[model samples]
Target: MSTEERLIESARALLWERGYTGTSPKAIQQRAGAGQGSMYHHFSGKPDLALAAIRRTAEEMRAEAEEQFSAPGTAVDRIGAYLRRERDVLRGCPIGRLTQDPDVMADPVLRAPVDETLAWLRGRLAEVLEEGCERGELVGAPDPRAVAATIVATLQGGYVLARAADSVQPFEQAVAGLLDFLAARVPTDHE
Candidate 1:
């Protein structure tokens, strides 16, 4: 790959593996196998390269989530599929991990993509729930926006809990609990 591409990819991996403060430009260069001059030529600085990486990561995440969100199923089923989707649970979320970094959270430029991506996720979830409610598949369902926020919060929190325990069971249990709650809202005729 080109030096610029390599730099961005390296930055993304480093940023995810180690938070913003931990990911130094020298480390990124070493990982990418690029020279200092090459990195400077491609990016203004570490933050610039990190922004590119963050944007790329966000786009990738949205695409992955869209696969299940757009799939054919009742909204509840689609959500179940999303919640149950395979993940490297011990590693935690790439974007969500940024929320724990003081530097990333303090810098608006670095934080924009993370903030926008999460807002989009919540909005997309709400849209699906609203669709199911309108179709009578989710009869008497609670407010879609609130439910969407809760789902995102739960997933993120699950990651934290799983990491703290050094196991994936907490994440799985969290998903199971959410699925159970959602199933209860499904109309009897639809079940």
Candidate 2:
């Protein structure tokens, strides 16, 4: 990879592992195997480099979600597929982890990609839910926006629960519980 690409990749990994406050320019340089001159030549500074990394991470997250969202299924089933997709449960979400960083949250530049990516996810999920209602796959006119938010919360919260327990079971259980709740929300013919 080019020096810039290497720096961004290194930044993404370091930021995910250490958060903004803990990731230093020197450390990023060392990890990228690039010198200070190369880094500065490519980026204005550490924050610039970090922003690139965050944007890359956000793009990757959106692409992954879109893949699942685009799959053929009822909205609920598509959502379940997304929740059940393989992930490094113990490592938690790269973008979600940034929400815990005080520096990232406090800096608007740092937070924009994170905020926009999550908003896009919620909006996309809501769209799917609306489509399901339109197609009669969902018998009830549930609030799509609320359901979308809840789904995101469940996933993010599951990561926290699993990380706290130092096990993936909590995450799996959380996802399973969410899937059950979603399935129950679907109206049967008897209803």
- For residues 1-191, could you state the per-residue lDDT of candidate 2 as single tens digits? 99999999999999989999999999999999999999999999999999999999999999999998999988888988899999999899999999999999999999999999999999999999898788777765559999889889989999999999999999999899888877876779522
Which structure among the candidates has the greatest lDDT? 1
Query: What's each prediction's clash count?
Result: 0, 0
In angstroms, how far off is 183's CA in candidate 1? 0.3
* 127 Cα displacement, candidate 2 (Å): 0.6
- Scored against the true structure, residue 45 in model 2 reaches a CA lDDT of 98
At residue 106, what lDDT does model 1 achieve? 98
The local lDDT score (0 to 100) that residue 151 gets in candidate 2 is 85
* Candidate 1 residue 64 C-alpha distance from true site, Å: 0.2
**Candidate 2 ranges beyond 4 A from true positions:** 189-191
